[model samples]
Target chain A: MAENPMEQFEVFKIGPSLLLNGTNVSLTNSSLFMIISVFLIILFFALGTRKLNIIPGKIQVLNELVFDFISKMINDTAGLDAKPYFSFILTLFLFILSLNMVGLFPYSFTVTSQIIVTFALATIIFIGVTIVGFIKNGVGFLKIFVPSGIPVFLLPLIIVIEIISYLSRPISLSVRLFANMLAGHTMLKVFGGFVVALGIYVGWLPLSFSIALIALEILVAFLQAYVFAVLSCIYLNDALHMHH
Target chain B: MKKILVVALFLLSISQGTYAKEGMPQLNPEFWIAQIFWLIITFFLLFFLIQKFFTPKILFTIEQRKNLISNLIKDSEDYKNKISVLENEYNQIITQAKKQAIDESLLLKVELNKRINEKKKKLADQLNIETEKVEKEIDDFKKKTLDNLPEIAGNFSTEIIEKIIGAKPNASNLKAIISEITDQEKKSRYV
Candidate 1:
């Protein structure tokens, strides 16, 4: 096992490296796991829903349950008008969730733990939502940053604050997911290292703690994914309806 | 606490790349482009696939299931309504048949009673005519016997005299004797 808990987060180039536009485009463990997660999601939905019996089988039940869960979540958060983008939001949630869960396995790479990957996803959402806002509401979309019914003197300050908060969305969104996964995995590795280093006689405490942490981390994984999806929905709602 | 210190030292030393070739590979700028590129490729491909194919398929299945259930319920309701209607018709038919049978029987009973009374009246009239004819025949026989009474009494006196003095009696006397005998018989029978 690697000595440093941080060592688990390292990305290593897997096949031959390629350079495009003066940037290295080499495939890495992160990409490999991302592909795996995508493949698993496809397989799950494809095979699970193939039969579509009136009385669903186990995998079919799981498929319907997940579908309904995301559907209801998006509907509640983004309203009925945002229904067209359900697939995109659901894909984002499943991809992140699968990546997080995959990271829990020993010797597995967590794609979401990388700031670059999360930032890329968050940036896409941010840019897409902004474009949607402009397209849907035209100049009225800018109203989101302006506070209504404020004292004349306080308008500028409040607008600046709102703009800052709006612009910081991508940063907060990306960092929250990346940091949660990175820190949780690191803690698990560190505690696990303790159990091994302390030996079996007195290591039971740390081992138990590691076990409990794993459970909590799993819960955290699910929660972070839910939070990420729900926040995206809220942003979409804002764009679609221009709620201040 | 000692374990925590050791773990912290290891993390710090790893970042320095003292023992490993890469410090923190997430910060190792060489792989960021590739990661983002692949992330985009995978995410959009997933998004398109789900949107175009999978989501629609599941939605269709759910729709089909709902329609199937509703149709079944509707068919059962139709069948229930149809059965009730048939039952109502059956009851109506049964009641109508019973009423018609009663009406027919009443008509038949009235016709039968009229026919019986007509036959009884004709038989009573025939019986009265036959009884009058029989009384007339009895009265004619009784008058013929009464007309022969004078001769029968003359003969009976002649027979008694011949037996006593060998001679006959007069016709008028015979007639008087017959009248006297008939009057005495009438007085004995009627009184």
Candidate 2:
């Protein structure tokens, strides 16, 4: 029998460990590619916006399209005051999106498929938003956890529930991305295995399904990035406006 | 700070336990460190490029367009005011020209009337002089004719008498003829 369909997700170490005081510290393929993706994103944007001319060239046009798109997104979701966050949000989106797309390549790891990576990103956003809330509102930041209009008697319980809800944000944010990428990739692999196992006559069906799923996965990759950025904007809006 | 420390300790313990699990792949700390390093690098680079290059250019273009529009508006307003002033000046010149023409015509009429009156006065003076001269000439011719009238009557009577009596009249008859001629002249003058 062929290997289990899910076994492809296993991580294997391929290099010697660099010992620092007898502790193993080493880089992996995943780390290497993550760094490479960041480098590429930086290079692309650097070259794209180098010449800021009146008439946009091809690269400049692409850059403007992305800039306009993100600016509009933040404006629509968080209002005009959110203009300050446009660059950060755009960068976050592009980085995540490119990582997701590169993950789709053969023999490459999906960094977001791992919980640690997604959790790390989500943690940064959560902490950043919380800091923004405190910085903007001072002691009034606690008001986010204690919504308005609740009776004094019910305030404590409600505040606790709100805190729990707030704490769950990172988990939900990370899991949503990780689960979608993991499930979609696993299914694609399973379908691909079926195409090889079954004869070419019956294999065409799974092959076609794989193709369709790949297309859907590509769309989902872009959508997940958009969702992540938009949610961050919403969180930032709550921080800035305290609209909870 | 305490929360961060607690979270770090908790993560470290969890990682240690997970590392002890048989057949499980080791979690590489360097991987995360590398990711964090790249993340900071990329974020700052992008932020600087956008802040320094892209944003300023866009804002400059927008400002330039605004200045251009304002200049055009100012120029148009100036043109409108100039046109209004020019129109007013044009009307003023036309009115002045009309007034000048009316004044010139009035002056010409006054000059023409004065010339006519002076000519009529000169003609009247010349006519009075001519009438006086003509009256003098007529009176002189009348006097000359009246003086010659006695001689002409005497000759006529002499011829008549020669024919009737076959001889010239004597001094007494001549005196009587002279007296009759004198009486007739007196009667014509009185009448």
Chain A TM-score vs. truth, each candidate: 0.96, 0.93
lDDT for model 2, on a 0 to 1 scale? Answer: 0.74
Best by lDDT: 1
Enumerate residue pairs that collide in model 2: none
* Predicted complexes: DockQ each: 0.30, 0.06
For residues B65-91, could you state the per-residue lDDT of candidate 2 as single tens digits?
568788999999999999999999999
User: What does the i-RMS of model 2 come to?
Assistant: 7.3
Off by over 4 Å in 2: A1-25, B1-191
Q: Is the docking of candidate 2 incorrect, acceptable, medium or high quality?
A: incorrect
Q: Could you give candidate 1's per-residue lDDT for residues B77-159 as a string of tens digits?
A: 99999999999999999999999999999999999999999999999999999999999998898778776766787788778
Worst 10 residues of 2 chain A by lDDT: A1-10
Which digits, one per residue and each the tens of the lDDT, describe model 2 over residues A109-179?
77766556777888888999899889989999989998888899999899889999999998878767766
